[model samples]
Target: MANFGRVIELTIDDMIFKMGTYAIEGTIPFDNDPIPNESEIKIWNLSPETIDRIKRGSIVAINAGYRGDVGLILHGFVSKVLTKWDGTDKITTVYVLDTDDISKRKVTDIAYAEGTLASYILRDMAAQLGLPVEQFELNQDFKYEDGYTANGEVTKIISDVAADCGTSAYVNKGKLYIRNLRYGADDVFMLSSGTGLIGSPEPFEDEDFKGFNLKSQLQYRITTASVIDLNCRRFNGRVHVRKGSHKFSATGDFMTEVEAILP
Candidate 1:
């Protein structure tokens, strides 16, 4: 079991925000189910040097975990920034989007002719956008029937590709994981009872009768992706993490709310 404590660190470009120096409260979200994952961090008491150094398009890194075992949970580019004054203090909120979001900004100038395999089209598009093809695992057997037209946004093109093949494409960590809608054992992480698991895992029914029931929910202090093993009753074997949110506050409350599906 790991020690009980909070780990929160943020860096923009090369300027690192030391703990107890600038940030006060923030939240970083992680998900790989379908949509692109993004994070919003609200920080208080930012110095002029820090504010001036950070701007839109700056690379940002957010790390959080228990004491001594902190990991880089989110590393992406800043999409937007907002600063406001609450009469007593200045609060700055930074919005960050993963590499997948950057792909959305690119549009394909060439079209995929019919008989072109989906994997080929995806590879071509990804290459043009500077995303390494090796980072993604695509279904080579899937082919385009009607072919695609030019001037299509890379984001939309990829979404259509995934939907046609009944798969999903999302950036997990720093790589693009494109695969069928099946959660394999390779996606497993440990959430021991006393290590990071906050309390008992609570079982619940899905509000909407669509997809698998996200039957289990728990909280932890670690921030990372992958299926989590819940050491508890009602949730045995591997459970898929459907959604998770990381909350980090300089005041010492740092945790992640995890929603998972029963195997």
Candidate 2:
């Protein structure tokens, strides 16, 4: 019982709740991928008091794994909640999507001079969504033409520019990160064989031909940030996280799988 207390720490709308067994599914966006990555959480037998706070648009953060503090597996706003009853038990599930979902709705139309720097334009777009810029390394010299219009969803404009520059842009933890494909080597987190890695990393072909030509799939017992390093053969040291899903249950166990690519 004591161990269970240390295994899962969940905060929803700044309020913590004790749950039976829970699971979270997440995916990190890259390239032309959708913004604000999506996640789903299933909680067992939640108290009425806790469920009341989980209205649509509430904030949620999760920390799980046996060693306890595994960092944030998923952070986003609640989209929907479903309640179910299985004979003598009650189950509640919450759906979540990163801030991008909310920001994408805010449409804007702004014109820039022919020589406007890409960084400045990006900053302006992000500001509309109240998201901070993490890195704006898109070619500074790259400029839009005179009478060019920056319009539509704020995230769409940023992503279109990133796609044009052969880079990627996405939102994580309420921050916008723009960088070259597979370029965050200095910040890579090491995943050793003894750690969460389940089996030998499997190689697969990427269905998104435009995104990348190669992909490596990994399964683990937990989920971390959107990016990580698979310290093994054929992974090219670091892989950009494309998608991840975590499924945890009190009676069964916890597991997370990630699909990544090299550049």
Candidate 3:
């Protein structure tokens, strides 16, 4: 698709606080691991009253894409808000954490009976933490042979349980997801020169996996654990996104970067 007319919509506490791309700038990252994602957004020139209304723990959601197409990019809670003057232009920076409440909550002495499914345990934990379930699928339904006891932070407990089941758990847009490591979301995004694939996909290798790092015109649909069908000069196939980020700036830098691996 042809990329044009950048758009950004930032909503705080269920109110549309800012819209348009020219004055909004920052990075929003998504991950496939078992931790919450954090985003930092800086808006230029906001009234003092508006900035004051944004408090810690307030709900925030950001939507960004081209004018004709837009999607929810980040939905989370505000962790901090800071304002300052930059050469007479006041800038308000908002720091947000995805699923902030669930990550910090502790599960104490929660016990499950033997022969309990991991999914059941996960759902129970989600209820205890007050997190909504977006998607939950395990390659194998692991049953606790000797039952199980959950403790510590909810994220950690979910991570440990997922590890035992040979899967990964993560929260996206305020919901929980548990799936196999080699797989991703069901919807696949086709990326090519005609569809906003910037330059060529670069080959990369790390200790755990080998994959490609790709850049495209700020794709709001692509997130961590998303499937992308990459079609370029050097490579053509489907890869699962391990991690990626969407970045927009007033300086004309608007792009999506993803590090994906073969599944």
Candidate 4:
């Protein structure tokens, strides 16, 4: 990607809004946690009718990149919309969550028979929530000998099932995914000076994991659990993304920050 001429397209319900020359600002964050990802976007100066269309619960999809390389970065329901005045500019901010309608719904008195596969239980939970399955990979499909009962919030239930199977479950781009922490997506993104690598990747360590913090020209393709082939002055190898954020603004801020660990 050339990393020139910023392009952003926001789709709200049936209406579409495009911005190339205008200012668009927002932050989109993703991770491997059980909860859905939330995004906050700000657009400057819109008509009253346009603002009216951006009500709560409206479907929203945001795509951005340099000119012709645009791609989907966020897809979810609008959780909130607020408009305010900044001098002569009227800014509208929209909050979105990447989960389906059943995020708040509860599963009551549902039980699975003994010897049931963990994958089947997860699929049924997803079906109940109306969330599509994007990727489901489990290293061990543990079978419950005493059977299983599903209760509480759908998100929690799904998380519990994943824990029993020794995996993690999360929603990405409005779809559900289950995988072990040691694994990630098969596709690899190369990051170097030529491919928008900003500076030397800084090394950090925690109690459980040690990884690098990376900054590069906004790369929309990178997501939670995506593999990165890093080629830099200090470090050169592959790492799996644990969490990251894509941040953009018309005031010269456009980049992707990632915290990744060796897998």
Please name the candidate that would achieve the greatest lDDT relative to the true structure.
Answer: 4
Error in Å for residue 55 of model 4:
1.6
lDDT string for model 3 (71-115, tens) is 999989998999999998999999999877566788789888988
Per-residue lDDT tens digits of candidate 1, residues 8-69? 67888987775666665666676653245678888887877778778888998877665666
Candidate 1: pairs in clash: none
* Residue pairs in clash, model 3: 1-195
What's the lDDT for all of these models? Answer: 0.62, 0.60, 0.84, 0.85
Tell me the alpha-carbon RMSD of every candidate: 3.9, 4.7, 2.1, 2.0
Clash statistics: count for each candidate: 0, 0, 1, 0
Ranking by lDDT: 4, 3, 1, 2
Badly placed stretches (over 4 Å) of model 1 are 1-3, 33-36, 100-109, 133-135, 138-140, 181-187, 200-225
Estimate, for each residue in 95-128, the C-alpha lDDT of model 4 and write its tens digit.
9887655567788989899888888888888888
TM-score winner, 2 or 4: 4
The model with the greater TM-score, 1 or 2, is 1
TM-score (C-alpha, index-matched) for candidate 2 = 0.77
Give the alpha carbon lDDT tens digit for every residue of 171-233 in model 2.
665667777545543455566555455556777674552222222222332222245656654
**Roughly what TM-score does model 3 have, to 2 decimal places?**
0.91
Cα lDDT for residue 189, model 3? 90
